[model samples]
Target: MKPPPGGLTAYEAAGARYERQPYNRSGRSGLKLPAVSLGLWHNFGDDRPVATSRAILRKAFDLGVTHFDLANNYGVPYGSAEANFGTIFQQDFLRYRDELIVSTKAGYDMWPGPYGEWGSRKYVLASLEQSLKRMRLDYVDIFYSHRPDPDTPLEETMGALDHAVRSGKALYAGVSNYSPEQTAQAARIMRELGTPLLIHQPSYSMVNRHIEGGLLDTLEQEGMGCIVYSPLQQGLLTDRYLKGVPDDSRAATSRFLSEEQVNRELAGGLNKIAEQRGQSLAQMALSWALRDPRVTSVLIGASSTAQLEANVAMVDGPPFTDDELAAIDELTGPASSANR
Candidate 1:
């Protein structure tokens, strides 16, 4: 494999990397994850250069980020992200496999079949098999049922996750995008099955505060940790869009974020708060999401190593005070009151 743009021929992890960040336990479980985990939901597909993906992975691990999150349909062509990560793993990360907390989910549509999606036993188990093959790993540290299946019985879905751990296909089980009620039910079933749910992955940000309603309390009551994704609200919480959306920004290209949803005024107000706190908007957003101890980590995606470095630096920022929190809530409006 070719080296990344910097022209380095070999890879050696940083010696002081562990000292650079803190690792928090996942709920009451013994597993510990980096305060900031890297997600490969974007920029790891064949649409982007492989060298760039390799570079980001290297930079993340070097910065003491041991977790890499993914899903089956993450790439443009579907399954491309895992396939690409598998190739890079062979080249660089294979040796550090034991030191990594690799995770992937499978509750969304991936292939053209009745069993290709949802939370059925067949689909969930089969997707794990396909994911294992794509990532070239004997087992992932955590296997999640990406979303709850309304049509399928919750018992059957949770049963599949239990089987994944029993079969040695995954070390821990998790669920993402599950509501508080759904999470409690899933945790109950998983606990009954003897493979307790380890964590919950949700979309959370200064603007997207839905999870704050009851999910955090639910996780705490159930003794499960929370790992939030899209903590930057798809880049809206950052200074990138305070001026205007860039041509290459996700707001410009992806349907998930749009120019109409940019909210420059809201971002501007939040940026002021971030500046007062002596941090960038992106860093402040991350630190804010992690303010609650119930939150185990904030999962982030980066287009470049520099972006990754800047984000991981949030761990070093000072904690939010009551006045700062109130100011943030005031800027975010009523949705932020749900948690309080």
Candidate 2:
């Protein structure tokens, strides 16, 4: 809770933040996000020291990771991620706010009561107001309806996103966790409202290829950019689980990834392929996620500056060849035991 030794000073970002990374255009829009963005879904909560979270944020920005994604229920205690991020931004990164693409979402369970969650206009707008207040910002670069609300009319949910942009509270509108058909509907609605959907954040990893089922095609046809989350599959695709789960791994501690999911026998084959390509399993997984042209960026999280550096290094790895792609397909194909 206390400030770092010297008491914070006016921090200057790294000159190399934009040097090595490549930026991808977001769905024909003027916005170009780094191929790899930083997500605050983990470790930026109340459980960790505020100084640790601040270091991660500063490192990410110093690496040219302009886009930072957040949601209403990101932290262990819900809202704390934004609160923590706001503090860091104010202390060190506020001056470069315009150079960053800070985003937050609503439409998830953040509190009690009927209006506490979902895609109702009341809930979406109110939740964003709370998020903005927590982040201490006037507007988010992109605001999303965190997930689909089956009971709510698509128009209403999409309208809330459109409203967020049109009203000067959000620079862009988006939706997350919606199906291919649902995404098409939301995009159509936003286009009709004159806002035009900006991006779609989905869970797409080597093992979890559900986005390949139809979502990627939908985004491509609609000219909407796709930024996927869980590119590491909660550590399932990383070296940490390839040699058996470490005592400190997420699988060992977080409910999101269970220890049983760590199947070294299944992952060993992919790890071998990664080694053949002279890349780490984590680096290979990130490269595989960006192979599709529709994907604008891959969202990654880090527990420390070292992990962040390793993930960002994927941008410099060699491209997958035809044989490598075939090998990967075989490894992640429906018949593969590792496919999840």
Candidate 1, 109: how far from true, in Å?
Answer: 0.5
Candidate 1 TM-score, C-alpha based:
0.96
Q: Specify the poorest-scoring 10-residue window by lDDT in model 2.
A: 1-10
Give model 1 RMSD, 1 decimal.
2.2
Q: Choose the strongest candidate by TM-score.
A: 1
lDDT of each: 0.91, 0.88
What TM-score, to 2 decimals, does candidate 2 have? 0.95
For residues 87-160, write the lDDT of model 2, one tens digit per residue.
88887877898999999998889999999998999999999999999999999999999899989999998888
Candidate 2 lDDT for residue 308: 95
Q: Which regions of candidate 2 fall more than 4 Å away from where they truly are?
A: 1-10, 334-340
Itemize residue pairs with steric clashes in candidate 2. Answer: none
